[model samples]
Target: MKNVLFIAVFLCSSFLRAQEGTNMKRVIVPPEIVKLAFEKEYPGKTPVWSEEYVGDDNDEIRYEAKYDVNKTTKALAIYDNLGNLKAYEMQISLSQLPPKAQSYLKKNYPAKAIKEIAVVVDDKNKTTYEVGIEKDSRFYDVVFDKNGGFDVIIEKN
Candidate 1:
């Protein structure tokens, strides 16, 4: 029928348009450049490095780099594998955290310094933020529910 043929043509055109929109040029960053930047940022701190190769369902490949600044501290840097810095973050403290998060830190980890904070959204569309703390050479990971209430606390000595 003409109606069925028209529907098929419309679906095919839409699919092609969607694919074209998602076709972006691959970005590459060289390892040497990343290394130089890392050194420049951390001056006297030498990095202990490790890397892993990852590929997406779309066949896009990337490299994940991890740098251990010290026995108790680390940094994560992601690249397209050609060495472009896709993302980078340095491990830091609670004082450098946002004001909304500071209140929770002061109340729960009075004597501890928050080393990391991660915000994650689950499949159910619920959002949770996790805070990691360090106290007396021990690490603690605490998760706060969507409402900012304490969910779970994990401690590692």
Candidate 2:
């Protein structure tokens, strides 16, 4: 099967990683568990792969599977190093968001234009919308509940 071949290749790559240790640079090919999870959840979708390292020293790495949900929406799911699903984000527009989310953004950030809108679905499938705004050379990801309640703001430099 194709999955089998994929897993074999992944294992080979991982063995190389284990031998070389963490100092290895360049993009990592994810283990089989990640591909299996992606297949089970999004059967018909083909994901374009990418990943990033988190933590102060970049000690932790997460894999991403990005795909399109529809003509207008682009979606991506994040997986932990062991291939557990963490969250999903869908790029959307204010008009595509739930009414409550749209209203909340309008009321709170009245003067600021939303640079990007994303619907974030956690592992439990709980959905939240994040509105992004760029101001003062910083990017802000403002989280809002489905009903448009304020959640939190994550500022990135």
TM-score of each: 0.38, 0.69
Model 2 is weakest, by summed lDDT over 10 consecutive residues, at 8-17
Per-residue lDDT tens digits for candidate 2, residues 3-95, read 322222222222212222532434456789898888898899987666665545767677877676887667777787778887777777788
RMSD of every prediction:
16.6, 11.1
Off by over 4 Å in 2: 1-28, 55-58, 110-112
With candidate 1 superimposed using the best TM-score fit, by how many Å does residue 149's alpha carbon deviate from the native?
A: 14
Candidate 1 Cα outliers beyond 4 Å, as residue runs: 1-45, 53-55, 68-73, 104-130, 133-157
lDDT tens digits by residue: candidate 1, 17-64: 222343232333347866676556557665444343333343544333
Model 2 vs. true fold: TM: 0.69
Name the lDDT value of residue 120 in candidate 1. Answer: 40
RMSD of 1: 16.6
Measured with C-alpha atoms, the lDDT of residue 60 in candidate 1 is 44
